[model samples]
Target: MKLQLAIDLEDIQGAIDLIQKTKDSIDIFEYGTPLVINFGLEGLKKIRAEFPDITLLADLKIMDVASYEVNQAFVYGADITTILGVAEDQSIKDAVKAAHEAGKELLVDMIGVQDIATRAREIDAFGADYIGTHTGYDLQALGQDPGGIKLTAAEEIKSANPDLLIIGGAISTVDDPATAAAEFKKLLG
Candidate 1:
């Protein structure tokens, strides 16, 4: 039931203000993919500086140069970093190792990856901290619901490794946190 607030858009200060106001209520703070792409690691560093106590996840959506990206994120104060499950197995392994070496966590983003079960199993073997059942913003904008998909992915990953932590993303509204938490509870039970 961890609530990760995704900060997207191009306004770093605006995002900082919102996070400053809401950080107490959220379990994790995420620098969204678009924001990271737009502002890079320095932007993530700024957010990290603002909230040193909070768990900061950088949604880098890393597809290549796994070690370098993960290292950069960790150095910039990211407690956790994300990698695409669709990426090469070597990349996933490298990133996972980098995360471990840096004392950080790795979140495998299972977005648009067809072999989710296989990838989940592989990530479990690599000891990823969490598996993110995520829907892209474009799909959400087109009215595709992520609840069911997230639940399904969570179930699949949990089956592979019951100890795995499942997180949901592309959750745009406030109501989504409760709904998703409830759904995840039911699935876990």
Candidate 2:
């Protein structure tokens, strides 16, 4: 089990500042979709260069051209890159191959997937380093709680493949992020 902090705000410096403040406690740092969209790949590079020891995940949420995008993410210093679960099978396979070849890891984001358990089982068998149940920002703003969804998905994935690392996102909205993160970390344990 690992505690991954997702940085989704607009400012790169603000994200960096927060990471610096909590660097010692978190297990992984995610350059969230908003941050990547705001600052490009440079956002990943800047933070990774500053904290060489922390594992960095770039939430590109790739849907196509997996190999090229995943490769580029690794080149930009991402230890892990994500792809959408709804993407074509070939794309997911390509992403996994690229990640493995680069000695990196791939996370399949099960965001819009209707059958998360089924897809998680398939992705785990296909060798994705992690299977994540992610709730989009819009969904979070609608007052949907991701904690229950995350736990349900984690339990489903754990039963299917205990070896696959399970990640839960959409936690930044929680009133007490520290307690929320700690509770999520315990899900895998």
TM-scores, all candidates, are: 0.77, 0.79
lDDT of 1 by residue, 1-189 (tens): 465667775368966876665555556778888888789889888888887888888989999999999999999989899999988889999999999988889998999987778778888898888877666767878888653235567666556654434343423334445455455545554
What TM-score would candidate 1 get against the native?
0.77
Q: What would the per-residue lDDT of candidate 2 be over residues 101-186, giving only the tens digit for each residue? A: 99999999999999999998999888998888767767878878563336457676556554334343435555555555556566
Best by TM-score: 2
| C-alpha positional error of residue 98 in candidate 1 after TM-score superposition, expressed in Å | 0.5
In angstroms, the error of model 2 at 86 is 0.3
lDDT of each: 0.75, 0.79
Best by lDDT: 2
C-alpha displacement of 46 in model 2, angstroms? 1.1
